[model samples]
Target: MRSMHSMRIASFRVQNYKCFVDTGEIKLTPGFNVFIGRNDAGKSALMEALSLRHTHNPHRSLETVRTPTSEPPSSAPTSVAYDLSPEELRQHLTALASFFLPTGPNASASVFATFRSLLETGDRFNADWANGVVVKADLAGLGGLRRDANRYASVLNLAHPSDVQLALQNEITGSYSSYGVVLANWLRDKAYAFRAERLGLGRCAAGPDKVLSPNAQNLAAVLNVLSSSNPARYKRLVEHVRIVFPHISGITSVIVEGSSVEARVWSIPLESERSDLSVPLNQSGTGIGQVLAILYVVVTSDLPSVILIDEPQSFLHPGAVRKLLEILRSYSQHQYIITTHSPTLITLTENDQLFAVRRQEGTNVSTVALIDPNRQDDLRMSLADVGVRLGDVFGADAILWVEGKTEETCFPELLRQLTKTPLHGVQILGVDSTDELGAKNAQRVFEIYSRLAGTASLLPPAVAFILDKEQRSETEIANIERMGRGMVRWLPFRMYENYLLQSACIANLLNAEDASSGKAVSSEDVQAWMERHGGEKKYFAPREPTAYSDADWPQHVHGAKLLHDLFNEFTDARVSYDKVKHGVLLTRQLLPNPSGALSELCKILDELIRGAPSYTE
Candidate 1:
């Protein structure tokens, strides 16, 4: 079975259909293509448009599919136009020509030349051409053919005069109405639309039908045939399923004793001292059935196909979704057009093209934007890297910009402890330092925020910026606050690490790190080390130390440098304070019982929350 095909739908256009008044030809990739959008944004509408084109029922009305308008529906027909390659055109004509041309030496050559001339001359027939000439070749039809005979002379000339009369008498009585019926059946066989909600199947009549239905209603029969005829493929399918669902040991079929009916089921191996068990697929959970159906199509497809899947992550776990995408990509013989709302799905697959579909406000039209994956700041790639998207930032109720990655991780933990609930719709983002923002002044930060907020209304309405004090003088801090219009808040301490100056937390971290060496650092040892090193006059509060007790060392000392020095002094322990790793760990520890500095930080966070714009769920 050959998987690669020379023909494919290159592009398509949908006009006056549902939310699409005129979706100027949307191009598709030969491989993985994704359409991502919110609900009712016309992603599924595009899938239905493709379905309408290749469906078997010819009388399926376009009246219900047309966009609502005051005028009669027939005034502007709802139509889908598919642009095919010349090779596909040749294949369509060849199938049609087979019915008319006789079996002889130059018959094949004549058929090819006739269609080649039709294609080269741009005199190809329309969708209804075969209906008039072949289906209803009465006197009126013959008169119609004579009127257009010059355009199809090559085709008429290919047949002997006797063969032409015979074809008109016999072949015209065949079932097909148009040449498109050949292409339609071909496409119907090669296309599969997967809808999880409609994917349930029961016991099917036993037969050799190996073709899985679009919704997999015939899954039992298909599996039954595959297991007997192609056991290798069936085994491969089970292996792939087990990768996603480890408990599924093997697949088997149970035949009804007196009837020719079988049920496809899977066996689960023994676990936790329990015996193995077999469960019918219909009795299994939807997630399991969905995975089996998806894997069945993916493994058994022996031709180049178009697989339409909507929200593939609906019933499956994230891990399963990731594995399914990996399996789909490994089999590149098919083109996959998936509609999804899961950022996990969007970020996981290496899609050939991603289209962001959006319905226009105050209009029925839906528009699509092709997102370039190669861009430096592509939203999906950003989600993969940092688990955040610009769209997420915009959708958030309030934005809190922090200094770096360390602060981004720790602040959320701190806020959760203070508020006693997760902050809803508040996004904590990590950004560069003040020096990186602008060397001269803080005005550049506002400029960057304004530029982001200006793009397509995609920024949160309320935003706050916070950065480390970082040895900045009182005058510099005042200047930044003034230049930033009070939007920026500078930490009172030297850095965020200063709030994490707990001796017990530091000792526990060191002990955990040096557990293998049977070495430990006590809280007393940490406190004594801090006292000796932190009581220096240079580390005093208010820029001067009258006495050790009067000075606030944690407030004035460089917290990052102190931790680095402590790690150096503890040579026996295999512990090193990674700013991101240890910083978050220490913050989590301090959050339960905050020190004076941490208490003050909590107050600042409370004030920010109170000042932020309120939002309703």
Candidate 2:
């Protein structure tokens, strides 16, 4: 068994394959590698190109896979080159020498030494697959070795010692007649490409073969073999299946007609007295089949394998996807190459290499940007400080930016009550302040947000900013609104706390909190407090008589300050108002009969939700 850190495919280059004209040597990590991009961005093309190195039929026509162009297909035959690490190069050379050299007179040792010497002086070794597979080496400084090759040919009993180079090439191209077939066979034993659509329902001819097929078509046969040959591993597989599907007590294979085997799941009965039911795996949900196939691959494949998965989340739920990722990570001996559009998967997987693939419109070439590991770490920490996961931002249909943490918690509840439905597709995010943008006008701030959102692929598509009107003049308010271009709006009040100034609701919240302390508050107490503080004149009066009405006084007063003073007035009681705690309580109390300000806010949100685009899988 190879060590967990054994040399794997370090990097690969693809040329003239579908959308990839020339993907210049995209690097990979030894552990987990992830590719993220939008629809039709050529992510799938890159995956297919990587899988080409392990294909069985190396002689397949290039016309079907080659990039279409005005030039002849022969001029641009599809090619994929894999760079070999030093360890891998040594392994291949060692194997080649052992297989070809005569046993006596230390012939194998001499040939291996020659190969090693060539490797030491060479710049790079690449396994290029185009018309056929060939190991290309930059042996520029090995002219003396080629001239003196007769020394190796004599021991190997070559017919023509002068043509030693030809004989060596023939030997490198294995007994399969072509190095392409040899390389393909080698990769087939070490790599597995998992495509969910290609997986068969768990049934296959019973055989002693324990190796799983690329698409897991032989899953049943593989399981049957494992059950008899390796009982411990078989038990482990059943235990893992139970973890992912709790209802499944065990997995068993039953031979039918003395020839074929079918995998079945034993479902635990709902009642203790009832016996467990055995059902064919085909009868189970597609999600379970996917999970079983994935688990079988991860659990049974040889060590140091390269597992390529395309959008596992497409077939599994978020929870199942998370569990599957955990299983994959636990098996640290294998390398993983996964492509997904699911932000949740990208956020959860701590990938060794992360690439953002993009292709311009009307172009066949695709480009990849490798996100720096340090930057990704910084992003994770920043999101953690805000109590958010990157997936949360990408999963929403639209983002509603609020002033602070208090509004972030209370706005959703208020909107849910007014609309009679939870805010399903909208995510309310709290910003430090709109003033942080340092823009003189609303349009400039919105423009900055739009530009920032444009660069961040994980951010939600539609964004709307809502903030307090503060002390802006009427003329200034009108100008801001006009310049906003529908992407920004003001609260029409000093702050969100202004809407929670209802005397009855405030008093009700206070009494509820003071119930255990043998103290109570009434609506009259709140009303009298307001009256003592100058009644409507003190709270609602405008500087100009004809400017606004007393009913609109909540818009001008400092409701947060007033609420704090009201809480201080209750010195005899044990209850006090907190902006986050009491603010939400007061908002809930006002749900039964929302104030005029809240109703208008609800109207604005409804319009925004209707216009915003909904998220799709």
The top-ranked prediction according to lDDT is: 2
* Candidate 1 per-residue C-alpha lDDT over 480-553 given as tens digits, one digit per residue, 9 for 90 to 100: 67756668887888789888888999988877766776767899999888877776554444466433244566
Candidate 2 lDDT over 251-306, as tens digits, reads: 77878776999988778652543323677777777777777766777788654668
lDDT of each: 0.60, 0.60
TM-score of each: 0.49, 0.50
Candidate 1's TM-score reads: 0.49
Candidate 2 lDDT trough over 10 residues, lowest sum: 148-157
TM-score, predicted candidate 2 vs. hidden true structure: 0.50
Give candidate 1 regions above 4 Å deviation. 1-7, 53-72, 75-176, 257-267, 270-276, 348-351, 374-617
Candidate 2, residue 171: how far the Cα is off, in Å: 8.4
User: Which 10-residue span in candidate 1 carries the lowest summed lDDT?
Assistant: 131-140
